[model samples]
Target: MKTPKFLLPVGLACATVLSLLSAFNMPSWANFKDAPKEIIDEVWQVVNREYVDPTFNNQNWQETRRKYLAKDYKSREDAYKSTREMLKGLGDPYTRFMDPKQYESMKVETSGDYQGVGIQLGLDEKTHELTVVSPIEDTPAFTAGVKPKDVLLSIDGRSTKGMDIDQAVNFIRGQAGTSVALKFRREGKPLTLSLVRTRIELKPVKYSLRTEGDRRVGYIRLSQFNAYAAKDMGNAVAKLTREQADGFILDLRSNPGGLLYASADIARLWLSEGTIVSTVDRDGQRESITVSRPAMTSKPLVVLVDGASASASEILGGALQDHHRAVLVGTRTYGKGLVQSVHSLSDGSGVAVTIAHYQTPSGRDINKKGIDPDIKVELTKEMAKNLKADQVATLADPQYARAVDVLGQQIAGMPVEQVVAAAGKPFPAERQPVAAENQTPVATP
Candidate 1:
């Protein structure tokens, strides 16, 4: 049967709309052909009908597809770069294209093993200058004389002023043989330092035994839940136990986070074999991360935390607290419950997206609401002075004293009040804040 002329034109138009809608549903222009025909058609139809952008056209899309499949783009490298540009047009940094080489590098970095100076660096909130938070002891950065409070100006002549902390780390990290020059300002003097990049396998957990007053307490600081953190923690605990540590102080003050698996493993040290943390995706799909019943010791514990404690820190703290395995001291923690999964891009750069938000074993949502300490204490001037003198900025920080005090009380079989009375009040009338006259802000002329 012969089709009507007007109906044929209308039918062709309808078909075009359907095809365009399908593309919208799948947005990956390069991969559209690989998708099911029905899905592709749906994407095209949706885009044609609902997309507010007036530039939508079948010809433009066809040309984009042709360029991707062209034979002249002989190398896989060329094809990937072209595809990357196409994805970048979307302007979402979270969804960029990365080649395999760059993607693999990211995977290595995320695994918490890389070649570089060992330091956690960040921008100064007040100065907006790059600052070294802490240099892991015994690493290239630590041995090469990188210090906290040192403001980085440049790395290899590249300005670090406007770069993010992660970017600075990337700049400093290189193959084991290469040397990176770092320029920094310390105490009004500009200093230049050069060091070779070496393999850095960070051990996140560190511990020591200290006799505070009459009781010997174990002090363990966990920097991040990296690949070896759980094992490191176990060894630290074992070492502390051999030292006859009467009580435990688990310090998780400035830790950011690393592997989720490591976090669960660390938590399992003091927790029963059960849900350490639960995750909820954007779609409301829920899953839980649990651990096996395996650990070195189950001693009376006190975990110290502050505003900088985040992610896996919260997970470990929440688990111990819920299980009555430890008492939390110091200040509120940093709440970062989102779990990121790295996806390799064709351009070598990896994209990490927040696939889920994790919850504590007790069903507490640790995303925005951080863990509150059982005992709140401020850092003492004396402790700060000690830290400054020892070149140990974080350890002698006030949070350390709080942890020791809490654990000391537990050892003596008395409340913190009894220990406070014996040691005398740390803060007296002289330590109280002095009040000044309330003044209004002066306007600049």
Candidate 2:
């Protein structure tokens, strides 16, 4: 899920005030017989005021608005179509238009509750194809054996050739118990699967203390950075710390990021100081966030990431890596670093506009170029299929086992570079010693 910009505390407050004013006041636009046109104009005004790119992808914004407004929209559907066309000119798939139902479904998703096959979808930046980011663990899609990097060919037998992410989402999600047929291109081979949609109340954070030889290791798998992710993560860290856990492995594999504030808040849990992340707005003004309070835990930490880790996942991983706060293991991340702010139109419809681009503390813009792990472990499809939810964090999971080995070295007061196991293969660890200026105190195991 792309982080909902306006849902953050300050933005939410501003939105609340605007909503209240719009509700009570009698607006002249309310009486427009062609109210559909009003929506088109509203979307235009929003993009005019808030889009991250002042050039609007080098298009003539006012002229384009004139062209769209000149058309006589027959219905709300017609206006929606025109609005989508208008947004598409910016050439950003992340900035999308959603109808009322799609908007509501998106809201439910950030709440960590929704009805669907439980798959996170993405548009490939390079291929321009609708791709599966990852499947939510133990959900219908995951159980059905859908894998990451899978290209979605069609939905319900309809071609997905030119369909945008939101449109494909509408086709796949339905009332619980409903079924949708999805054809995917994996390994250049066509494979089809049918999944029954179900109401998914996702638990954003799952943690347990594991006994690895003589060390007590805390395992926390963060599946999403939804609304409740920060609180749940804090609770898990505190509980594990109370249990005298020697170190921690924070698994962010396949965690399609959630709310922006959630990532910032979760970063505060691990980082006592240093920049969490920073954003550059349309005018080039930069905003950087850092936690002033003490962290929840200072024990040695290692992070697990993969190709499906994106957006806020990249944000958190980048911040920690740059600050020398944690050692990362696995493949590079899913590069989706642009920030979006979703807005509800006067009508029930909504629009997600790309409002800002962010950077890590070290000033790395991990947009298309994702952050690389210190230890690169290529988990093949066969290995992934065998590593179910129950097997994760266990010896059966190579990535998790690799992370455990790194954390073990840290607990033993050894440099991270000494650890050399990737999926049981002798791989060179890319861990660089913490920069002299970036060192922070941590508890020794």
Candidate 3:
């Protein structure tokens, strides 16, 4: 919900867990000997006290802890396995354990820089296989021809059949100049690609000006909502406005959302007042409310989103859509409305526990149920292939083209509400009921 202001500095993925750890004067684990129980107790205590669902999803958390606590851990790995098993019972994917290495990697990524082959991975629930969510544009993976929905068969020749998402990522990531061989199945055909890992410095926001039917549209692509997201977007919008751009298209196509405050700050650029998003804690009480400030640039806006758009991305998009500030184009969002607060452990390891569930301005719970686009446009197989091959200009992207078209017809100085009304969509006037206490926040990534 309302993380300490300090936690809001970086991307949600890179929130400062160490700060929280330091405040409690947590003891350090010098070694693994006799550390299993302490680590387990720390996790259990945090979840017991702060988990968003106070009922522990209707299960007896005390008993659950007893079940794990009764086990005799022979080593650190055994303790990790037991802790993971215990968390699995909660059925929340976003809330999980991260070892020291994984936590460090997360910190690097959220800092908007990392040394790795850039690609986002997820677990396929039904098949229990690793899948490629998307490749960071222009990264080693994207340049090597990775695509969304590609089934990862192996990493560096090791079979990935049973590997978790974190394991797969670790295996694929390496120092700059080193190569990681990725074996994947695409279109039912097994294929292998050798990608040389490198330093990935993410310029989260990229912009361009496109002319459609004599109208200049500012096209801003937000790859991730990291620390620089708001400032970068503000600069892009300001420059575009100076260039006399009549409309704006905020592209969040493959964006896996980042920091909470980053999203709120970006929303403030458009919305002058009213709630942007709200977080409800485990006790069904409001934890924090992010409201809009003065408008930045009120140019007619369209937000482009796809299934890969999630978390903070959903927050920004949902807020604009609810306030009639932007017409959402493309498919539904990835829907990750749950909030995770990372906490460091004494062993340099960490846990990102779900502390609250976020609601859009209209009070809609978009956890598993994502926000639908006002106009739907699917990226066809042919279009995707052509676009990937650099055969089509980004202006030819079906979704971008549609957004430009919609914005072209909008009156340049019309109010956002009037623009939505002209498109035959009714702007929501009231917030919906808060989510019920028993509602589970579990979902596959």
Model 3 earns a TM-score of: 0.86
How do all models score by TM-score? Answer: 0.64, 0.87, 0.86
lDDT value, candidate 3, whole model: 0.75
Task: Assess the local accuracy of residue 69 in candidate 3 as a C-alpha lDDT between 0 and 100.
Answer: 69
Candidate achieving higher lDDT, 1 or 2:
2
All predictions: root-mean-square deviation over Cα? 15.1, 6.0, 5.5
Best by lDDT: 2
User: Candidate 1: what lDDT?
Assistant: 0.59
Give per-residue CA lDDT, model 3, range 1-445, as digits (tens).
1122123211245333334322232333233325676677677767776778878878999788667766778777788877777777787666677777987777777788888888887666568788887798879998888887889998887999757676676777778999888899999999999889999998888898877778988889898788799999999988999999988999888887778878888888887866677777887876444443578787789999999888888989998887778889899988778888777777766677888888886788898788988778898787787674553226667887778777876645666566556667665566332433344422111
Candidate 1 per-residue C-alpha lDDT over 31-109 given as tens digits, one digit per residue, 9 for 90 to 100: 4343323222222233233222234322364454444444345455555555545433432222323345544544565
User: In model 2, what is the error at residue 405, expressed in angstroms?
Assistant: 1.3
Q: What is each predicted model's overall lDDT from 0 to 1?
A: 0.59, 0.78, 0.75
Model 3 stretches with alpha carbons more than 4 Å out: 1-34, 125-128, 388-393, 412-445
